[model samples]
Target: MRKLGVKAAAAAVILASPAAAEMEYSFYIGSQSAPHSVLSGTIDGTAGTAIDSTVAWEGRSTAPPPYYGMRGVYWRESGWGYGLEFTHAKAYASDADRASLGFDSLEFTDGHNIITANIHRRWKNQWWNGRLTPFVTAGVGVAMPHVDIQHGGGAHTFGYQLTGPAARLGAGVSMAITDRMSAFTEYQFTYSDNKIDLDSGGTLETSLITNALNFGISYSF
Candidate 1:
């Protein structure tokens, strides 16, 4: 009964938050970018794999989704923000090419993601755009990255609890379609570290960089 009480209290806090500057249901779709760093481990600077597409679920500084996992929003500086995301991708390598030399002689694929609890502040228009303003944010959170590899009858998966340091330089625009609702789109760049085992049994540490150019629709209450 105590566990249920704790859950109820948390839910009450979320329902009590006022609209405007609160996190609504926000969804995103994009691709995993090259690995970058304040540290190192990126191949050829900040470009690694091709494109591992993904879909993410994000909520603002409100109650988190219970059915999805432990993901929600919080405060950082003076504003509110959250980056609750998860994704998967797949690829195929030729088994007939001369480049197959000593490889598994089959397809190679991987899937990875991170649920970063970043903080953000939304601003009204500054110049003359009327509904657009350049907003900036910076925060840190947990980065749990995972990868899976398959060959013949064997499959390998690597994952861990890592660190996430991120920054957002983007602009947003919104207009009221009704009295209590608005919609917007934002473009951002996100960065994180990668704990990679490019090949089996050979562990390599590096930072994986991701550029998030996003389009989103939200309904505020």
Candidate 2:
């Protein structure tokens, strides 16, 4: 009879669980890619070693097959959402070519890595309502870019560390493949200025503007 009573209490507690407890925490990683545009345009596009450049970007949250598009995880409703995202990106300038003289004979490469954290608010049944599960978030991250420049018959390496603001927005769907696990995906953008300063006062600042195609998975407590 004692065992029966314990089982009955367990059933009652399970039935009484609050829906908000259903909110999940997520963790994820994607292809880490960053593209950069070097200013002071080598051949000289700016004054005082400033820059004049334009560039394109791609988000690096690269995924393997199977859950192909499962790049995002559901966020919590009321407070902080903790997770790690890996970013990869590349940059190039059509105007920064050898015709510019900076490349006597040329080859160059640029990429960056970033990690971030954010605060969230479930737009629907959220911290505000438990049924409207849509959500949005904004946060900040740090970036490390590896720069390789091959010019004037030599290779130069410059590593850059950048930190700045980032923002994300998306709608929430079912949070799991099954219970105890949940998933979500959102469109996010991180903006940072990656710069390299030279003792000669000549500098290269590739305001690494990044856009990511991020995706990942998570387990909740």
Candidate 3:
């Protein structure tokens, strides 16, 4: 009788294992907005004085280089999950800043890219016949922004740079569309600390906080 009970328990474990874990892949696109931050740096090498100015950022979401993101997650039945996410977010210094600060070109429109490893917690709700799930996520990673700055009659500093550290927090809800598909909308807040090196000389330092609203679809397997 003891041997039979042990065998039955083993069979139950095997049967439940497949349903206990799953993998999900998602793609999303959205718009972003950033508040004004101070941008400070030195130009023309060590011969120049420090430049400090308040910069207003513009998010050209509808134009070229739109905002987008992708992620892959692995979920356990316990409502906990882990994933990697990549976001292509942009920022352009406003015209007022350019005219006032006398910058010929200043932007990270090509990429204010962020890559992070995220942890998520989700809850299953009875809304819409148990199809709605609400989740929150937090992550930390690095910022790789394309530094585009030309000022003080110096050479153009245009290239990708591993500027500094980045972190994000987000919350959203997902609706099940099919057995293996779901749709979601989320809001994310990201902070990046940038210490970018300039081509003609010293480094530019700034902290950017961005807010994004995103919608997308996911597939689970």
Best by lDDT: 3
Per-prediction TM-score: 0.50, 0.54, 0.95
Residue 166 CA displacement from its true place in model 3, Å: 0.4
Instruction: Give per-candidate clash totals.
Output: 4, 31, 0
The clash tally of candidate 2 reads 31
Q: Would you list the C-alpha lDDT of every candidate in the order shown?
A: 0.39, 0.45, 0.89
**TM-score of the candidate numbered 1?**
0.50
Error at 127, model 2, angstroms: 16
lDDT tens digits by residue: candidate 3, 1-221: 99999999999999989989999999999889878899987775566757798899987866688888899989998999999999888889998897788778888877889989999999966478899999999999999988888885678999999999999999999999998999999999999999978887777889988899999999999
- What tens digits encode model 1's per-residue C-alpha lDDT throughout 72-108? 3332323556655432212223334313222242211
Which pairs clash inside model 1? Answer: 23-60, 35-208, 35-209, 36-209
Residue ranges of candidate 3 with Cα displaced over 4 Å: none
Clashes in candidate 1: how many?
A: 4
Q: Following a full C-alpha superposition, what root-mean-square deviation does model 2 have from the true structure?
A: 7.6
* Better-scoring candidate (TM-score), 2 or 3: 3
User: lDDT tens string, model 2, 1-221?
Assistant: 99999999998888766544434445444443445544544322244433354443333233322111222334443434544444444443434454353533221233444455555555433432343244555556665555444344434444553533433333343344555654555555556665544323344555555454445555655
Cα lDDT for residue 153, candidate 3: 67
Candidate closest to the true structure, highest TM-score = 3
